[model samples]
Target: MAKTTKTGRPISLDSVKANQVIELLKSGHYMQTALEVAGMPRSTVYAWMNGTRAQNSRKIQDFVDTIKKANAEAEQALVQVVRTAALGYTVERVKQKFVNQQNEQGEWVPVMVEQEIIRETKRDWQAAMTILERRWPDRWGRRPPTINHEENEVTSEDLPEDFL
Candidate 1:
């Protein structure tokens, strides 16, 4: 029931497309692409998002919070998925079938052999741990220790300044 602009399009804030745009944005879509997906104009979307029109600052802040929450949840979920993949990896003895030459002829033969094969999940786990460490450096990151030698250190100041 909102008035249409001179271009015969309803104001973005008052139109149903606002929710569509917001939903796309919350799901990690870029602003321009999200609005494009919703078939809305960039100027209208920016106006509403920037609080240039009837929409106020608080609404824009809520949109920002939604995007942040989505990001955090995605990060946590990524770590969890990677952890599961990594933990499932194990080095174990596995029987593998291979084609090998077993005669004077060039014919190939199938041989069953047992060997130690490392599961690929180990790499996935390491990757997950790396990502987690990078994301939460304080909790899972490595910090080079700062060692001080003040007590047992010799001071250059005690040396003669004219030693040169």
Candidate 2:
């Protein structure tokens, strides 16, 4: 399998369409001719021919389940190779580029990392809320203030960024 530049994700090209191209190649068609016949992109066809495109976990799991269920040893072995390649992503070289500066009290704080994560989570939550609101406007829309509402009870602005 081929590897991606980021995360070194395994790339798989064992789709039904690729199989058809492979069949054409095995039947004496030139690889280039086969790929052209398949109408697939050059990069995609090259990846398929080289067996390098199966980097997705869901696809790996599907392959494993399929071969195991069918009890096909050869196919199972191929699936195992795909699974192994897909799982071969290395994080060892992922150096911690972040260096936390010490405060006056000499305590190193992860302020930036924490803030970025919080911001990203908040953005994701807001996007989810927007989707939910679009899906069910009446259910999520603002309601009229009740006469018996508690004075101490917080309104929407009191909620956290992500929660709101």
Candidate 3:
């Protein structure tokens, strides 16, 4: 296919497919996959969204909305994962399998074996904090302390007297 020219919009792009891409994006799919569904390249999408093409292009708002929606959904999911893990989770499972047993006839026979497994999970505090910082910056972010210097400009005379 020919590259998108002055408009920076792929010739293959269509509203139905573009909406599908947005849905996929909102579902937390990668950009490459979303672009594929949209039948466009990343460059073309960005150009259309960021106004490299027409400022008032209908695609711009739709693209922006798609990105924002996707980001919000992803962030929400991340926050939920972290929160759920922090709250602590437990899993209990039962597994059944067949094991080979030596029969009285000196032939192997299948025997059913049962096993129970229990697991407990917790979120990584540091990693969860990182996600929280990214998702809810104002609430969970830890900002580096700012150091304010008293001196605005230092002249030669402001240097230590001992140096002179």
Local accuracy of candidate 3 as per-residue lDDT tens digits, 1-164 = 88875743344456777787778877778877888877767876776666665546555676667777786897688677777776666766666688999999999998988665756565567766766787799988888876656756667888998887
Q: Which stretches of candidate 2 lie over 4 Å from their true place?
A: 1-14, 48-54, 57-164
**Residue 9: error of model 3 in Å?**
7.1
Q: Which predicted model would earn the best TM-score?
A: 3
- Candidate 3 residues lying further than 4 Å off, grouped into runs, are 1-13, 90-164
TM-score of each: 0.37, 0.24, 0.47
Give candidate 1 misplaced runs (Cα > 4 Å): 1-11, 14-16, 22-28, 43-54, 57-76, 86-123, 136-164
lDDT of each: 0.64, 0.54, 0.72
Candidate no. 3 TM-score? 0.47
Q: Write the per-residue lDDT of candidate 2 for residues 26-85, one digit (tens) a residue.
A: 455655676688775677545533558653556645543543343344444554555444
Among the numbered candidates, top lDDT falls to 3
The sequence of per-residue lDDT tens digits that candidate 1 reaches over residues 52-150 is 756445655565465456556656666676776766656556656666757668677876565556554344657767876888999999889776788
lDDT of 2 at 161: 90
